[model samples]
Target: MKKILFLTFAALLMVVSCKKDPLDQTPDGKITLEEVFTDKDRTEAYLSTAYSRIPDYFWKYSFFAFLAGITDEAKDSDVGNNAGNIASFWNTGSLSLSTNPLEAYGGQGKGISRYVTYWSGIRDCNVFLANIPKASVANEDYRKRFTAEAKVLRSFYYLELIKQFGGMPIVDKPFEVTFDYASLKRPTFQECVNFIVKNCDEAIAEPQFPLRITLETERGRFTKAVAYAIKSQALLYNASPLWNPTNDVAKWTASANASKEAIAALAATGQFALHPNYGNYFLNQSDLSPSPGDKETIFEINEASNGTFSVINSIPSKPGMFKAGSCPSQELVDAYDMQINPIAGGVAGEPAILGYSDADHLQPIINNSGPGPASGYARARPYVGRDPRFYATVWFNGAQYDNINGAIHTIETFQGGADQLIKNPPNRANTHTGYYLRKFIDPRIQSNQPHNSRWKKYRLAEIYLNLAEAENEANGPTAAAYAAVNVVRNRSQMPNLPVGLDKDQFRVRVRRERRVEFAMEEHRFWDVRRWKILDQTDKVVTGMEIIKDPITGAFTYNRFVTERRNAWTDKYLIFPIPLGEASIIPDFDLHQNPGW
Candidate 1:
């Protein structure tokens, strides 16, 4: 009898152990939400979550925000901060970057570590999603909605992951410490692409995918359109030379097919359309309000309206560049088409307004154009008729820029220190990439002045680029693709671009437009990588000033700024997998990308 009783107790203890780990159980007879969600609702949170997180460097420092800005072929200045020390990420060691620059080189300390923390975001989605079925939400409808939520979150994570680490493990189950991550090997590019595709599809199918009825429908939520955009973007990424397995033509075809499908899915939902006016691409005239106004923005992550909300890494230090980081590279500027060949400007013979200028840059292009606002006013002309978006994005000499209020705008009449002539000035753009980012910021945002500012993580322009590039690469031009690309320019108030542009020429033009349009948004470096054109990166950095002499009635080189040094190395391409991750795996054979 005693032996039988002990056996029964042991059995009961085992049952308790299994059931006691419940996430939603309450002490009372009633089940709590935690228990209910553990049994079910977890997926709801997963399906809808925002993408903005502040790491150490960019949260308060704001220097790191411009990581994207520097990647483009744009120009940036220190304004009056950090002795013009900004401009290193894009111009170093062959204009290339090693995977470990933050660790091995720049000693960016917490920066890289902070960046990888986003993985926790991925992991959180994973854990929450894996447990959704384990929970039992009281409402059946809630349960179904939660399931969709998890998928959307999963898709969002994959989008960010592939961009950084090429292909990674697509974990579906809760990870046990015993889980053999070491034994895990990186999957082929196609595998990664496929996983992303599946997640995107699932996210769209989500019955509860964000429905945009209010101002904040986008606040902390993922929508069906967002998923399709990512899917399209991923395929476009795959079709690029970097991932397409050049030897395998089959992969290219697959990538093209993926893009077409993505577009169709988006269209099928009838959720997204182009935002119309191009001038609204950046945060608009209102200091207190900014909306892409149903035209320029399709989907975007919400940064806080309180200018203090997201410490903007994308913006240069307001009045003075406090952080000596993220200036520009001259090679990026050289990429602009001649004035008559404005690509983004949306019209032919669009005046190409470049930033190069000589010491005496005040000279005028047309003798009557007269001396620049100041002698040696670095200005590029044939600048008119160019894509309106281009002007909105870059801060150029001789162009008027608006103060945050929208009423008080100023044309960049003189270089940061040209009028002051302070040799010992602490903060100013000194390196080759002299221009600074103007596109992604609120023009109303003043230097170092505290005001509510908002930044976008996604937008319609990217969608159009994704569509145009994918369509062009896949089936050639469709009226929709051309219209999509053209709208960005037209709305920017650029002249109308002629149709019938060929793939090769139009593709390069598109590439340059993306570079400038998204300058400092940090897409260029990766875009170049995906396209397999790291070799095109120049090792040195410099800038030019468009000089026209009113007196001579002719164009002359008074000489623009030059880096007078080399800043790039080859290893800057693919970042090395974290050394720690490789150290545990046997035969880790993971070769670091060149320059590190």
Candidate 2:
């Protein structure tokens, strides 16, 4: 049943092969645009081709591993002699314009060759918009809405480009095959922002475009809310230090207003709100958000095909199970607060796990409860009393795995344990950081049940965070700013930011909140870059090694720097345009990024 559902969705997304020829042109056997517009099905299919090209956050073709490998969020353990070995790249920081995984183009082959340039995707959107008027779809309203969807999607593609490469060429309309490549010059960063905002406005102005889609079958389709979310995100990026380096307060004001507009539009629909359980929101279980009323997720990539290997790859390679991939680093695990003392009845003598200390974060030395006999802290059981999200997101050494099969199993990531480095095969199994991601791995997956793990692109929680950051920057931590961030904190059961925090203090809180909230969701990699703090945050990747005593059966934990984090510079802020594209252009306008 799930397979059929996947197939139907995939059909709507109509996958197209990568363009073999550099110059965009109609294929010899391809039907003309007039013929396509004359038939409703063919026209819709043409638009679906662009939809299929929407950048997938967790594309299974890339081994279901993400940019998290390089960031502090997690470490990948796909260490082998194969062509796809990037474990060293993440730690070494040796990525170049020709070999960076973030801008990988060409085709979706195995390993690092999994991203698209999106130039062809944007071209397809332009063609669709140009030819949509002639479509005899019977419903004028549907055609208008379809055109709006194309426009929003095109703007989103541009957002993806600008976020990574800064200013980019603004190609609004389709050009002739004879158009000169050297004539193209990237517009200013502000110009690119204006282009995206203008496209979003055009989409929203369309009368047929619905603010929110009410149908379950079309849950993942673009809507007015999606456009607003994109606008809010783009504006927020524009307000960031990377773009607004002068600390322009007006940019912050613009970003705050855009975010408020998104929140207002979503609130008016009464169809969107924060999901109560932050942890279960990622899982496909119906408890948190049943179909038709899923209020939290603003935008998601509904997988268009079956046979996704990401789930299996993420599953820990047990005695005879799947290969382990994407090991969450200790750096991420330490970010979760230790809520409860491992000892019962709040008794003392147990080592305190108050979370990372201000002095030395790598070591867990803070005593949440001041030195006392009633404190229930325990060093061996540090997972207790942490945020609810910690359990849902990280699979630590002693964490329980009750979601799998019918019985409960304790995850043993300790030395020589079930998921430990030595226990599993060294070549293709085991975790590099003695941790695994539990957020998106469905428990019923091993039972062969349908798993609906989705990569949520935008959610209300993110908007709340965006509002908090922007509001504080613009208004110096007002009540409204506190309220926005408190919404997310309250949902996760974490305490709100202390009252009377100055603007700079609140700003620091907001940044840390983003890291904890969106840990493994692929947000940190860009957030640090945009904030221009690569020198401080991207210094080193660390992992935890546990040594178990055979006689006493006790475990000793040690934190050590991993080999993947070596060199970094300010030049890594924006990815270099692929050498393939830059080399072909004869003009200085298309030069590679500095220090490429």
Candidate 3:
């Protein structure tokens, strides 16, 4: 019989009011906390439960549902068609405190229940930390390491919470059933950031915690690097414009220092660096492996082998495919830097040569616009001479794509083509943006084959970018900041930023670099929110409308609005607190976000 540890506390009842599964019952159908901690296996099982709340970015039910769809980066095909699609809730502006699709308060759902499950996970961590010392079989070293892991996990949960809901009620311990839950209050955003940083520091200082996890068995466990990564990311978010509206240089300096410390700590081990091949880094299974795998990956969630990702995101013309999932927006495609400047007489290696002519990304900067030498960009042939990352990320009209059976097929997204957007009858399964997602879809995974896909939560490139942004904001684009951002650009074979950019110009470059570098990686969703640029970005998403001439075989490209999102208001800067939690508690101190 399978045994289970149950924390029947009134605090838990306030959030997760569901009943336990009968299959998870013990032989006697009940196991107490004392009975659980006395046994090493049960104690370890309890700790494992705490790790279960980490958001799975690949699945449709979790935060992934809204990450790409609600942003200007892509338009999710699943919206408006798929029942219970969470992205639709945010897309149509139908989301309310009571009607939150992402909230899994009952704890009987598939995806990561952002609010209730995370709180439950935090409670589990608290219980494990308080009782692990009582485990008879675990030695002192084992107990210490386990305690540090729980602490790091707790901090991680808090970080995720703050990213979505701003400040949250700090719950450090597992309260009893009789404890007054109404007495809890939300702390200030800075206080929450400090608390998370403190927990991370505590975990890092633990003597039992290894600098890096070298053993295959301990691959996903918390390490000193993971702790540092959590610290760096939290500090970076806190220093962002949304949180630090005064543009505090001290906050930026602190974020930069944290990122610098993280980079130095990892560099000391000499095991972490950027992967050479950008495309193969996501496709190759070996690159996603632990330790001996891609050294760039600081922390990743290894998901079960499932081949549906390729079919779901591929063009509808592909055999055995379902629908095009997140179609890359024309705005996103225009963010890639051109190989040569779009202006005449502009040579190779010159910096700031982006493809678009304006901030709205409506006009393409074509070759030979002026009198001198050609810029290498052509209006008709838009795909040629662009950044290499563009090819790795989006499947354009003429791009060659591999099928499940290892067959090469060219995707044709032009009007009347096989992958065209069929809107006459409104076939929502087609690509709305004239492009399909090419990143993170394994070409080798056949229909019957199962392949393990890893979602990188924290990587070395992000830390470098974080350092660059923080430094640029703190000290107005210093040489150190240039070197950091240039490392990431050089790795992708793109030229470095120009030498004479001021603070504001360098800031624009950093944001653009992040948009292209981390496209579709769940970064764009939060980056815009943190930067407080959602009003400009999320207002309208554009797509390419390619019309092919029947007689001359010439192509005409036009930009059209794929979606005009309604949730771009300032209130959307942060998600509203779930209705149940906000309304159920009479004296609940969790105030709703503005304009909610």
Candidate 4:
């Protein structure tokens, strides 16, 4: 009976794959579904298909597409008409219902890459769950584990959808062609959150689910930690200002509890902690696996060694490198705090301890205002005495780069310098913002040698930040909240946030911490949206212009607006459902988001 059922399942998958319709789930009668599940390999292969839609964030052209380009963090250098340059589409405010680069319903060729859509992933999960019990595998434990993994993946898909599209259709089972697509209605925001959280809970309860993946072969598979991470993230989004407009403390409290629980669960395993070296965590090849290797990484997408990042985002003057992709913005550079202590012979608080003179960042907070000899941050030497992460993340005008051929080169982005931005001929490979990204690009990687890269999807530091933000929002700047934020700050050798801060003041500190800590890891794009602060952050991005006076050998600094963005409206808080999906059935009432 089991063998017959498995073949029937295989036949269903064959039919499903052949259909062009995004909503098509009807099984054609060509092959038996039982035949597919009867064979252990086939059954496992079906499960693998569900995992294929997980976003390859490390890939430059995938979902979010090096998201820094669209946010205040950075700007993409690809200004041409390249179809794969999705960031350009966003920077120009070209995203519409009919033409969204970030749409998730349709598959690869339709608009975005094959890995961007989540609806198809959810469908695959539903199909696998409904048919997995009929498989003839000898180990029941394996069957249970597979089922749990599907549930978590489905929940994760929903989480991704909600992050971009707000509430979505809650389709839990495979539908037949005869199923009435017009009858489907989008659920309420809270309803959607509840459903995703419920699915995560179900996956976590499965006895076979490992808290932290220890086996090398099963490295990327969903574990109890992944499920908890999803739950915590969903709750945090729910409690955000965009969703919780009422400023409800209860929502924040719930989010705090969920995050606290996730932290405790991971702690109980004793398998996760902050990776020792803040700069090396992102580029370290030896610590790619979960256990006994960077325990801070709760989930990561491992990729083969490739110099694609180096070729695209490296300094334009470097050999075999092209465009300085996603150049770090001056706004981002200003976020890194100045070192607190003063230089020799300077009073403790005489010099400016902050990075910027004002919140607008129009002027730098200079050290030794009268300027006998600089003690802290001086506008003339703006990069001095900044946070350590600043050194790890940005390649400024005077930064040194070690070449693969055993030579050290000093990067010069000043006017008329070798790496200076070209305007008349417009060298797209040059840095537009006077700084190149140094966070993810491994210095050892040349055009010939690719470095193994891993995108940390869910790290222990993020969990700590989530907890800190939620706890602060719920109960003010409590001791627990400070502790959470300090753990992340201390890892970078930065001083702790000052004590006795008011709630509003602490809020600013938390947001600034996230901006600098996650710099180009794709957090700023979503962080601003969730906090409802896009109008402030997405309006204008600035860049620095350094001029060298050859006669006196003095350098002058100037700030200029790199680009004026067009997509900071409240309507942009959540994306519009793709027109095709929104109007699939005339009366389906999928309900496009307001102001689309």
Model 3 Cα lDDT, one tens digit per residue, 468-488: 999999998999899889999
* Tens-digit lDDT string for candidate 1 (219-318): 4455565666667677777777767756354554555565456545553454444555444544532121133235334444333344432223222323
Model 3, runs deviating above 4 Å: 1-10, 13-29, 62-66, 103-111, 284-291, 340-344, 349-376, 403-407, 584-590
lDDT of each prediction vs. the true structure? 0.47, 0.68, 0.75, 0.75
Error of 2 at 194 (Å): 1.1
Q: After superposition on all CA atoms, what RMSD does each candidate show versus the true structure?
A: 9.2, 7.3, 4.9, 5.6
Top-down lDDT ranking = 4, 3, 2, 1
- For 216-275, candidate 4 gives per-residue lDDT tens digits of 778688888899899888988899998899989998998888888888888656778888
* Cα deviation of 389, candidate 1, in Å: 1.7
Clashes of 2: 8
Tens digit of per-residue lDDT, candidate 2, span 1-596: 12222332122222232233332224445655556678888888888877867755654434545567677777666644223645445445657766864433222332233224365567678778877877767599989999999999988888887887777778776654334555567577789888889989889889899877666666667888789888889989999998998989998998898888888888546768888778778775222223444687778875433434434445454323455667777767766654444556663222234345432246665554564333344456556677677788887877777655466777777787866754233445667777777777765455334567777888888888999999999999999899998888888877666687899978877887788889878789889888988766666656677887999988887776553455458888887766555654443224566667
Winner by TM-score between candidate 2 and candidate 1: 2
**Which pairs in model 2 have colliding backbones?**
91-564, 91-565, 92-564, 339-385, 339-386, 340-385, 346-374, 347-375
